[model samples]
Target chain A: MGIEHDTLVAISKSWGLFYLIALAIAATAYALWPSNAKRFEHAKNSILDDDDKPLK
Target chain B: MPQRADAAALSYRDCVSAKIKCLRYYRQQKKRVSRDRVSLLFMGDNDMISQLTSTERQYALVILVLMSLCGLVMAAGGRGDPLGVHGFVVLAFSVGLAFVLISGFYAPQPDPEQQTQYYDDPTKVGIALTMAWAVFGMFFGVWVASLLAWPDLTFDQAWSSFGRMRPVHTTGVIFGFGGNALIATSFHVLQRTSRARLSDQLSPWFVLFGFNLFCVLAVSGYFMGITQSKEYAEPEWYADIWLVIVWIVYFAIYLRTLARRKEPHIYVANWYYMAFILVVAVLHIVNNLAVPISFGSAKSYSLFSGVQDAMTQWWYGHNAVAFFLTAGFLGMMYYYLPKHAGRPIYSYRLSIISFWGITFFYMWAGSHHLHYTALPQWVQTLGMSFSAMLLVPSWASAGNALATLNGAWHKVRDDATLRFMMVAAVFYGIATFEGSFMAMRPVNALSHYTDWTVGHVHAGTLGWNSMIVFGAFYALVPWLWKRESMYSPKLVEVHFWLALAGAVVYVFAMWNSGIIQGLMWRTYTENGVLAYSFLDSVEAMHPYYIARAFGGLLFLTGTIICSYNIWMTVRAGKALATDNDAEGDIPVFARNAVQAGE
Candidate 1:
């Protein structure tokens, strides 16, 4: 039995911002997790590998 | 071994002769390498060192012949005619094309190789055109700014009138300069990040040439007083249709390349570029719905009317900034800033969040430009809310860029290129914040129809867009020309100061003028009558306009210097190869064969 404020304004205020913020946070967390470090590092350095050559 | 009395003299003689021989060999080798480098500069890297196929040679010949014919016809038909601007332009362009074709066909080509690499000629052409248009656009920009300061500069010519030339400046900068830069850089970045060459060479060339053709038509149409009266979407129906065709090819080419990407995860920068290409196509087509007067005429009437037209136009206009100006440039920022700084993006996760947030939210936020109009109230609310939420993603991206410089602060301080990029990020942060607030109804009441809006646009364009473009150019020129560094680091520093000073002065002048104008328009006497006449507000704006002109002059000076710097850098590369240990040696990037190696 949580508190209930079911009006449009209240619902948007509570859920809309909260949901987006949460999603952003979760995405960030997933990205920063220890296991994903290698993937990001590889992606970052890929550009440097061919830096001597033109992108073509 | 004989130990003769003259042994010392003999030994010295041999040593001097040996040294002389070594020096002579060194000079010859240098000459050979220099000649090879010159050839490589004209034709791109070793991969492109091949003769054209017979079909290609034939195509060039045919095009050159056709262009010559076109030039002759146009010049003959329009002889001594007063209203022959279009004819003159066409004739000149055709002649130029003919000359280019002749040179391209006649130029020496190396033997054909077993395999060909990616085509970079289009990118090179795009870069050259970008620099050319940047100079032309900024010149027009300064001219218009001067016109505002002194209306007498109009000289009573319809062609040179402020009204006509204003779009020339805007379109020149946005489409001509900015657009070309985006196309060139996107081609370069896409290939590098995706680890794939552009899927087809011909399509990319078609896109670049076709897009520029549209630009010429649009600018020329404006001079002839031809318009559908839409802001930033001013091209007539034929031009719009042509752009639609070109854009489709662009989208197809981009997708084809991405499909060939070697990477498992599509990079964040590509995501931004994709959004720009896709969304711009949608926005351009939807907003440009109109019926033409005739096939030959440059006239059209919008399919929508009244408040609906206003809504549609602003929707297209605001998002033009979103996708065309912001997203594409942001894509450049994401790739270039990190590359220049020699660091990984501080948070790959944040970039993903920011990308999605910007793409989803920016579409809805366009409606905010129609606020306080007859558009439905709910729509306005939706627009405002979306704009507010946009701050998060916008900041996220900017934050990511700044954060990447955490350990690279020394580079930012020492390297003008990185400094330009970092400053651009800061400007992006400032402009986006201003945008969100201005969308609010309370703030819009004062800011709308005032100079404040103008200041905001320049803050983004001059500050965010131009600075980042300069940074990219600095990074690109040495690499493209195979040089060690810029012609002069001192000049880069000077250009940076001039650009910073100009943008700051321009933005502040507009801000001051805008606030005063807005306040005066809203002011009323105690009897409830307006305190200041509209003309009075305009009269008060004289000093600020002059100040803006001064600011524009500074920026123009900086741009000219940049153009000269790049030109000299290329020339210096040639000079360095031949000169014996010249003062301005090649930059490390050129000598080391890569920028910042392990």
Candidate 2:
């Protein structure tokens, strides 16, 4: 019931690299996208303040 | 009426009195179980029974009862085996927990207004458990290190042998001390970052206690000579299964809390924690696929054998370090380092770049552990190349942390807590570079089975992982308990020096000894035959082993002092009840205004 070792390696060498690289690109794009800059900026400063009370 | 008895039994005067007695009782009870927040939680009268809704408490009781029943069955069915002993251990543990729950079962429900505030009782318990495990783990560490130096310290017992206790020390510190710290800080950071309380009350407790149960099983199993013999993945089949169940609940809690976040974007720390949790689950399940000889036996055989088995083991081993030790702590550094420094992260963009970089590179670098072994040469080279690539992301995060301390240099000098984190970053950089260098083909030939590898691991574990944990504890303990600071700042300074000295001593001793040992093994006489006997190299290791043990003692001493400092701080909080820090967490979104996230 076990798969062949060479087959597993071949698939990992091909599809695995592609999947990982694509994910990396997507993550980087999400980070550097211009419109999202404000959100990142706000999130950076979010924990610094004492105005953390839940909305009444 | 039975549930209300807990409240009735623990009045204000009675609690204060017990608090006084508990602190006195705590030191003596350290060798066995107790001295954790569990006892302290029950002793406190303020919001005592109201933290959990009645239904949640009953939910916990039912689960505990079922768990205890399972333990009883195991104990009965596996009567002649070591599995039976573990079954009794589980029964004691679960039944003890059940009593705590049943005692609080009939208490009044928590106020609806409490839903508005962040739930932190679990975090409080987690910190206590972390320190308890720290002491428990490091005690074994020092004992085992002493065994190496002296070799006759084994007190005439089967359990005291080095084979069993080494895993105890590793599993203890890694899962016990480090894992509990990760869970505690994750809970605290998740609430403040997401501006949401935990989604469900019972599940957080489930995750926390359940994870501890797995740690207990792993450590105790090693004591009883029950292991699957994988380096880090050693806790046989059943304990592994229990961990899987606990992990899924943990991840679900994280996802649920994130789903209810008030912010538009998830923070960087949560990303690291997510990777830590998600990747560890994958690593664990894949590496631990084994078949038991029978339903009652504590033994199991791995699915793969030969080179594939070795590769799989190293892949799991190396990545456990990647996800469990490195990534989780980096997630912690992302939050606590910046928060403690009172500065924003140096570059949000760098955080993103490094996060993705680490995520991509670390998964493939495990093959480096199998270099010069039976693993394929091509795979080894791939591992080496990827390990070298890891330096970029590793240094990126380390630099990001150090850079964020740019304007806070004065705090780094004046505040010992911040200095702990600063030194952690420096060591993180040093260790990652050392790791990449050692993974190369030529270097691996010298360093593969030598003390050099041990030195590198300690440099990472002691310097990076343990230091950052102390930093987080120093920062978070005060905030969680509403105290102004640690019980004694002077002791923190003392701890920093001791820990630094310990790590330096341990790592350097190993480096010198490792090179000598490696050189001796590779050396040949003028007649082209082997020069030194293996015993000569072993005898040559005597002094360095002694030095390493002394270093570990220093580190363990510092940890003991830290535990005392934290314990006194908890006591200090109880004494000056109103000398409180502000209740600062993330602000949840309002009902009517810009509907960003709920």
Candidate 3:
């Protein structure tokens, strides 16, 4: 039973890594999608504005 | 001729003004109609129709198919218990999911005003429910401890009665209470920090419903003796899966909000919250790697055994204490302490250093729990060393929090919430110091298998977790309900003293009893034979147990009083309506002052 459990654990570890990679890909794609492009532009403009603002 | 020219100019100005008015009215009407149409399509009737999107439908179908396959495997192995509660929970979850997806698809094109209030009221309800549950849990805990002390109690009877109730009390406080508080507050925090109302209405409800559902399943399953028997990881496979799903959504919501944040730097509190969420997810998934025997059954086998299993379990367990209990509360401390005290953090540098130190060291300290067991001696040594080293970061945080109150002592006197948080920091310092001491080999020899461990845990859980939770509740209720002050300041004072005195008595009594028991167990008759019977140690504990129960009762009483105080505040406390354009929710106290002046 111990040996069988160990093997199953190893399988799960590998599967988890794969799932993590998939999640990352999905997340990145979602962020960079066309619908979000305007948001990105707005964020970029805001960042530039911050660079110009004086320290509080 | 001059009069005619003046009249012509006035007529032209009037015509321009009328044209602009007509255009503005037309636009307003269009917006109103679109918003109404969207609301009808999304929120009108069936919640299910609102939740299910094409993508979500596909995901649910896949899960359903996979579950059926797993069910078949379970049937083949003659294990079929999980199919009952598990099936119903999954179906309910699917219905909720469908509603959210459909809502996302048809929801109005973001009216800021309407969206702002949607999650606002529900989150307050969640907070109130959480406080109620916590008080109930304390009552249950005191009851269980009393029963455990009863002389007439048989092993079977004791186990049957309190064994089930113990897990319920634990889960009720931790997941039910702590989980709700964290979820509700995080929603509020994330929104303010991000400078955006929540993205969607249905998602917040989904997260809230999913969390409560997990709690229900965990507590009920434990009573049925359906558990994996892993301490702190007792919830079986089905419940674990539900948490994973809920957690993923929670993570997404937080991330999406952060992506849209108006703040330049993610606030220190947010960093701590994110770490807690991310690390706990990793820990839960890794430690709970199990294969179910069937869909509806409680029986499942963890995929790690012997030393490996021990290692993995403690890794999950200690960190469960560290992240779930410690880190999350630390996030609350960072936010609420400063906000209530009206002071800046003493040192951002200290906060950052301690945060990193805690995250790094706590993972290694779990092996201390397995000291002197079948685990490797080297692992034990590492665990002990790391546990000792952990004091630096722990104290760093405690010191930083205390130091933040350097000029704010007056607030501590009048503000019961600040008092709770200040005491929580002190308890954190004491608990961490004791924890480090207990990890040493010499001390572990005396403390292991004794009531000392129990005392240590309560110091952390009751002293640290409960106090921090109380502080958060005090901070949150007024703000959430838009009230000026708590219903009774005197009751808050009474609660603080009661809880503090209870913790002190409880810990000191248990510590003394545990050490005496340990010494008695190891004592030898001058001729090199064991001197004390096991019953002798048991006999020694009777008085202490009685004292401990008294302590628990006091704490329980304090908690009940607190719940009442909060309930009354919600019911009859004067509302404040301070304008908050950027974040729609008014500061409760500020609003009250304004109303009073008016």
Candidate 4:
């Protein structure tokens, strides 16, 4: 038998929309939370650290 | 402890003091075995196999032997089929590798103190291989482009036909060239940001060469007319299964290294890289779910069919662009852009926002590829909406990269290497916007199957992906080789201009041809009949095809120039002991060694 296109379409449009919205909000919150600013600041400059020289 | 290259130039007293200080540093380090004492100080540019312990060396050989046995079984069992040819190829690769390992079997064991330094042997070879693929791949790319213009410009053999050769070009550039860059740079960035060595020595080699084996099998299969007919995921079932094993090792190595990380937070670049690796595994497995006809045959049927299959393939196809091309290159952009400019990323929070946004929005957007098809209309609208929204995050990343250059604009002007990155970020912004625009239904009506799609793909690949990789390579080569700079900054300047002209000419010609073809197809006669025949549209594209081929030749020439310059840098460039790009490693042993004042 062929699939039920309408039922699947309804689920995708409704639930998919809500799920992504909530996920986006949570992600933004994690990025911009006030208490986390200091950690982000340190991480920014961290990778610029030079590698060690040969022993001498 | 040992002689340094600088020791010869030093005054006699300073040389002795430096040596004494190095010895003291080694003595203080409790991890070093007594046998490793002198050898640890001599760890400069030793051949690859000499850097492994005897046990690891033997471990590698055992693994290769088992692989060869599998190949041998396939060769014996799958005789008189295309599978036999592939099996024999695999057997040759394994046997060749085993022979090399046996030759190097008696080399001295590596120093345990190597754990203190980041492992770079695979990354070094990975870079050389990246260039090799770039030259090889871009040559195929130019040939493919010219074939579209001339149509009879190939050898009179089915193997050289466009159907076979097109995949060779795509796989060559994407998996061969771009994949190597991602692997090589990921190792460097991961070690630097996490400030930890790779999880183990053996697995990095396994991942690099194993991935290359998959690439080799993929392109070679196309030459033999063996494919599952999936775009991008074109390799047959055996090759696919082999990749799953390789990818698992790759993932485990990444996670294991992250577990050993010294930093409190995972860096944003690593988040993009992790997403690239993880999502690609999921995408690959899902899209390539096909049942082979039998054990000995190279034929297979996809588990999905019809519109469902259409949806699945686009789901894999678009996200391959999203993750493989976009995410991995973004990982490179984040690390290398700020690095060359000596500026920090403009907004760390924005990086996180861009990462999460693209990751979320992109998967749904693949349905846009199925627009105006038998797929339901609402699904197309949903893909269109999400795709338009995706423009926000893509631009955020690109803008953040550009905004990083606020204080370093002078570097962009004077340094061609830095300019390559700056231009790449601009192209990223353009291509993403173009992608969003084309995903909409009305735009898709005009642009979907025309040269516009080809143009858009090239806009991303040539303008964005390859540009950033060259920038990263230019920045990395000197640092990895311990040279002062590239062999020629002048040649780099030449390369950048050539690449820019090629992308510009190719894109503009395609844009012109695609619009003309679309408009010709859509226009109606006075009595409301279709206007142009298919042949008419084909005729209109001929001149522009020639223009595009010439443009491709320009890009190929630049790639060739890049390969030669890198070769010269490796061969004749001055060698130095280390780069002073950063203040050096912050790990405890390195800190202590720095304090030793050698």
Q: Give the candidate number with the greatest TM-score.
A: 4
Candidate 2 per-residue lDDT over residues B1-598, each given as its tens digit: 8666665655655557656655654553453234455465323223444578877787888999989998998899778988888899899999998877776677777778778877788888898899999989988998998898888898888899999999999999999999999999999888888888899899988899999999999999998899999999999898899999999999999999999998778999999999999999999999999999886889899998988888898899999999999999998999998888878998898899899989889888999988778887878988998899999999999999999999889989999999999999999999999999998989998998989998999999999999999998898877665544678999999999999999999999999989999999999999999999999999999999999888888899999999989887766443312211233332211111222221
State the lDDT at B159 in candidate 3. Answer: 43
Model 1 regions lying over 4 Å from their true place: A1-37, A50-56, B1-99, B106-118, B574-598
Candidate 3's TM-score reads 0.76
Pairs of residues clashing in candidate 4: A50-B582, A50-B583, A50-B584
Clashing pairs in 2: none
**Residue B110 accuracy (lDDT) in model 1:** 41
Ranking according to DockQ, highest score first: 2, 4, 1, 3
lDDT of 3 by residue, B1-598 (tens): 9777777776666567546645654564455455544332222122333334445445554654554454454344433464465555555555554554444555434432343342454366577667777877777778667766774443565344776778877888888888887887778766654555566554666687678878877877776677788888889887798799889888888898777666666666777788888999999999999998755466789999889999999989999988988888898888777766666677665676677778777987999998899987767887898899899889999999999999989989878789999999999999999999999988999899999998999998788888988887787777665556787878989999999998988888889888998999999998999999999889888889889889999998898898889877765454432333233245543333333212
Q: Is 1 or 2 the stronger prediction by TM-score? A: 2
Off by over 4 Å in 3: A1-56, B1-112, B115-119, B151-159, B577-584, B589-598
The DockQ score of candidate 1 comes to: 0.19
Q: What lDDT score goes with residue B477 in model 4?
A: 78
Every model: Cα RMSD to truth = 7.6, 8.5, 11.3, 6.5
| lDDT (10s digit) by residue, model 4, range B266-370 | 899998988999999999999999998988988889999999899999999999999999999999999988877777899999999999999989998999999
Clashes of each: 2, 0, 17, 3
lDDT tens readout by residue for model 1, B1-598:
4565357666566467546645764575465456655343344333331345445555645754664464455446545532234445545665665555555555465444211343456676687778888989889999998898899898999988988999999999999999999998898888778767677555676688768877887888788886778999988776788799889999898899889887877777888888999999999999999986654345679989987798888888988999999899999998888877767788887887788788777887877888788887766887898999999999998899999999889989999998999999999999999999999988988998998998999999999999999998898777665455788888999999999999999999999999999999999999999999999999999999999999988999999999888867765443323122321223343343421211
Model 4's lDDT to the true fold? 0.85
Total backbone clashes of model 4?
3
What would the TM-scores of all predictions be? 0.83, 0.90, 0.76, 0.91
Report lDDT (CA) for all predictions. 0.78, 0.85, 0.73, 0.85
Q: What level of docking quality does candidate 1 show? A: incorrect
